[model samples]
Target: MNVRSARGAAARLAGRKGEIWAAIWLMARGYRILGFRLKTPQAEIDLLAKRGPILAVVEVKRRASLGAALEAVGHDQRQRLRRAGVTLAARRPSLAGASVRLDLMALAPGKLPRHIPDAWKGE
Candidate 1:
């Protein structure tokens, strides 16, 4: 494999690890994982979770810093995730009546995962 492909693979692996950690962290905090790497036409949701009546649409990022991880999701990405969440809820009967929330799970080395709820709301 070329250098670019190898780097891409490594990044993907790290992202998968981050998603797993994020899911575990959420579960520990009373959230139940519904899906992982859920691909819709509009976007890919890193993790889907639920706690009570809230359906959390999570975007997981592993960056050098928690702030960088939070900033990694930009305007366009947020829009896509919003659309994707709507589409997912419309198609999934089980998600009916649950409030959809966009969440960001930031993972950095030597630190616990940071979860930001309603991350892009009113932004």
Candidate 2:
């Protein structure tokens, strides 16, 4: 493989590792993982979790710093998450009454994952 392809592969592998680490962290914290890489026409939610009556749509952003990671999830991403959550609720009527929330999971190298619950309000 060329240099560019090798770098891309490495990056992709790193991201997958980060996602796995994040999922493990969440599981240890008692959050039951419902889905991963949930994709719709509008957007993709990295993880879907359930803790009691709360349904959390999680966006995982892994970077060297929290600022850089959090910045990755911009306005467009938030809107897509909202739409995806709505679609999830529509498809699963059981989740209709559950409290839906947008959560940001920021993972920085050598740092504990930051779980920002209710990171955004559907506005």
**RMSD of each candidate?**
1.1, 1.6
Question: CA lDDT of 55 in candidate 1?
Answer: 90
TM-score of each prediction? 0.94, 0.89
**Model 1: per-residue lDDT, tens digit, 31-66?**
999899999999999999999999999999888887
Best by TM-score: 1
> For candidate 2, lDDT tens digit of each residue in 1-123?
999999999987877787777788888988888888888887887888888888888888888887887778889878888788878976897777777788888888789889888876655
lDDT per model vs. reference: 0.91, 0.83
Candidate 1 Cα misplacement greater than 4 A, ranges: none
Q: Candidate 2: misplaced stretches above 4 Å?
A: 121-123
